[model samples]
Target: MDQKTNEEMLMFVEKATAGDKEALETVLLSAQDLVFNLSLRMLGTFADAEDAAQDILLKIMTHLSSFQKQSAFSTWVFRIAVNHLKNYKKHMFAQRPLSFEFYGTDIENGKSGEVPDLTQDVEKSLLAEELKLSCTNVMLQCLDAESRCVFVLGTMFKLDSRIAGEILDMTPEAYRQRLSRVRKKMADFLKIYCGEYGGGKCRCEDRVNYAIQSHRLNPKQLDYTEAGEIPLQTMLEVKKAMEETDDFAQNFAFCKPYEAPERTKRFVREFLDSPQLSVIRNAEGRG
Candidate 1:
């Protein structure tokens, strides 16, 4: 978001903190996509990301009054999201953690022959694209939670080092160094194993059938490919413009923003109408 949008969001925050339910909805809606995309990248699945995004939205609501305008509202939301996700233990990937070594081995040993055509009625190319998106997204899980957050914010979201530092509670210098290291690690892994961006021969198209058979991806119910609200070309243009300084930009370009779950607005409406929200607003008004 640009400075104008941030300023607009802050105005909504002012009204929201003062018990304007409509403004509260506006604030939540504004932050929902950012929170959800961050959660999805960090947690590695739509179901887990959706659950985490809702919880993070609630935290944003409960802490609405405490938002000090020292930084962009989106940055503050990112902080809350990072804090929540770093501590979040119930996500599936959190329970079964991943490491680059394991991921590299999986890529190296993964089945890679032409299997029976599983595309059925769907176009083969579409299935291949879905698998490619899904596979690359799962690759983020190989990083530890902190590194994953840094990669998502620094590379994927293109957050500036200083602002990212503010969100992560680190000095800009430190954040830059961490981001550099994380990028190199991801780049090295991709160079050795990922064919799309590197020399290694792991083609996403070749693995589509194997992925479907193994239940890693479902051709019928594609997740990542189907959830994008932003047009791929537009997002690619934005990413291309934002990511000029890295070799892995193409590797990271696949991390596009997804549409927030439709039920998010419904949840906000329900919360706004609830008695619990009334008590909270009353307390904030008193405070």
Candidate 2:
């Protein structure tokens, strides 16, 4: 049944490729689900995903003429999907850190399954949840724009090193090497501040909550400090981008409210619920 569906879907793709509007729309409907999934995983928020999804569809329609069938139809669409998402991440990270999740002090040590000793515990389960949320926000904040982009794209999208590297315009080996550094830096940072989980010594079977990255660490290579580092000279550009983002958010209602909707907000919150997204925040009243 699934195979037959693919055959039918391909026929629609053929027509869409020939510039049939109805066929294009049908093919897009089939493809948009993947686009939405990519957006959700890559962007880590429902609001962001919806916005990215909408933009992708529009780009498909607008650039439909440019899509040469040198690759598979899905591949063409995915290329657009990848580009749109990378742009969105670059925009958001430049603006401000999006909120994440909060687990607890034992986050990175791979002890998530130990089941909280509620009855015999000091803090309630609610505190754990709050900490998880705070932790996620802080992690996002710590990630420089490129690091956040690479980690989310490689991790959530689950793209192979080669493909992920292709999306970022780098060779496969370079991509893996750089990715290793990004992951290592992020994991090391999270452990120190968020209270460590995922032992560097844990084997494949035991390292569950956080997989101890057996891969080599290359922090210096993946470090963006040399590129966009917010130094004394670069402060002006950083401030300008922040100010623009603030202005955009302030007037976001008039621009586009994709990420602000209730449904999307809930989706983002759910995505952030993962222990890894956890971060510490200085929010005063509402968490």
Candidate 3:
């Protein structure tokens, strides 16, 4: 059977709920980066990020029954993230980790360790480790729970504000206001760090603009739907799908350049053995 958008995701969750360990792993594998990035930004410690990610996933597995599809699956997943952060914050306040490293050094007040030397022409932080820690922590400190949920959902993950609002139980207007506040705070941080988009300091805005300029967002630039690096069969399936959908080409263009490196060829060869994505690819062709 062809899995509609969100159908497969929900079925995957259902399998996990039924104690299908492999299905649970597949869900995590699909969303590992999303979980890790959110936790990393929210908690401000890689260790804490890992803990939070796992805890949230496990918690979701336990509470999968509560997900009645009231919102987009992504939003539902993120609501779990929001609740996890609240628990994490409570833990942080109860027992503060007095000494921590920023970019790899002990900062007196949890500031980002100085930005590493910039890319010769960029003159910006380039989202280096230190800069992420610094900016993320600054943002975290400023946001209350609702604001943080909105910020993480709307900005970082690029969820629609309406979806984010739904996840956080806020009115659309309220969500927009929170998003505005988050953007203002982000702008303030960037102004301080990069001096109005890297004039005197370094900024992520420059990096973002550069990415956009490079046409990185152009669908022709990536092949996300193609799922390259799979087996010959999956490759054929992906290729067929690529030929079928103009939208797939555009949407996946940014991912095409990411063909697996030779170093990981051996591992990928094994992973491509899965038939999981092949059905979707075939359906795309028929569509």
* Best candidate, TM-score: 1
| lDDT head-to-head 1 vs 3, winner | 1
Candidate 2 wrong stretches, greater than 4 Å: 1-10, 19-22, 41-44, 89-93, 97-141, 195-287
Cα lDDT tens digits, model 2, 1-287, are 11124446567766865646567556655555556655654554444666777667667655665656564455466678777766675444436544323222233444535533332232333333323332343354455545655655454333565555655677767766666676666565444444223333323223222221321112222111122211221111111111110111211111111112334334334433444222311121123
Alpha-carbon lDDT, every model? 0.79, 0.44, 0.47
> Judged by lDDT against the true structure, how good is candidate 1?
0.79
User: Which regions of candidate 1 deviate over 4 angstroms?
Assistant: 1-4, 231-246, 282-287
lDDT for each residue of candidate 3 in 247-269, tens digit (9 for 90 to 100): 11222111111222232332223
Ranking by lDDT: 1, 3, 2
95-171: candidate 1 lDDT, tens digit per residue = 78888888788777776575677666777788888887777788899888888988898777877777888888898
Error of 2 at 14 (Å): 2.0
Better of 2 and 3 by TM-score: 3
**TM-score, cand. 3:** 0.54
- Give each prediction's root-mean-square deviation over alpha carbons: 3.3, 18.9, 13.5
In what order do the candidates fall by TM-score, top score first? 1, 3, 2
Better of 1 and 2 by lDDT: 1
lDDT of 3 at 214: 32
TM-score of each: 0.89, 0.48, 0.54
Candidate 3 worst ten-residue window by lDDT? 234-243
